[model samples]
Target: MATINPVKFIQQVRAEVSKVVWPTRREVLLTTVMVFIMAALAAAFFAVVDLLIRTGLSGIYGIFG
Candidate 1:
């Protein structure tokens, strides 16, 4: 295996970092909004399913109580 020189290694790392494509502020805002919207929809869906299951189990338990 080849060993890296400290200064050259740092330069290479900086070069690679400079090549990265970063999102703009507007793009980040749009993506964040979409994520929240999807999360809210998923939460609503699970809440309905959970309510149905709880109601069903309560009825089953009441039969023996």
Candidate 2:
């Protein structure tokens, strides 16, 4: 294996980092909001499904037990 010099490695790392396209603040905010919205929607969907299943099981037990 070849070992890299620390100074050269730092320079290469900075050069590559400079080429990155960082997101704008507005873009970041929009994506963050969308993620929260989707998470809330997913949580709500699962809550409804769980309630339905629980209600169904309760009904079945009421009849048999």
Which number leads on lDDT?
2
lDDT string for model 2 (1-34, tens) is 9998999999999999999999999999999999
After aligning candidate 1 to the native by TM-score, how far in Å is the CA of 21 from where it should be? 0.4
* lDDT scores of the candidates, listed in order: 0.98, 0.99
Q: Which regions of candidate 2 are displaced past 4 Å?
A: none
Cα displacement (Å) at residue 30, model 2 = 0.2
Top TM-score prediction, candidate number: 2
Q: Which residue pairs come into collision in candidate 2?
A: none
lDDT for each residue of candidate 1 in 22-42, tens digit (9 for 90 to 100): 999999999999999999999
Per-residue lDDT, model 2, residue 9, is: 97
Model 2 residue 48 lDDT score: 100
Please estimate how well model 2 matches the true structure, expressed as its whole-model Cα lDDT.
Answer: 0.99
Q: List the residue pairs that clash in candidate 1.
A: none
Q: Output candidate 2 Cα RMSD.
A: 0.8
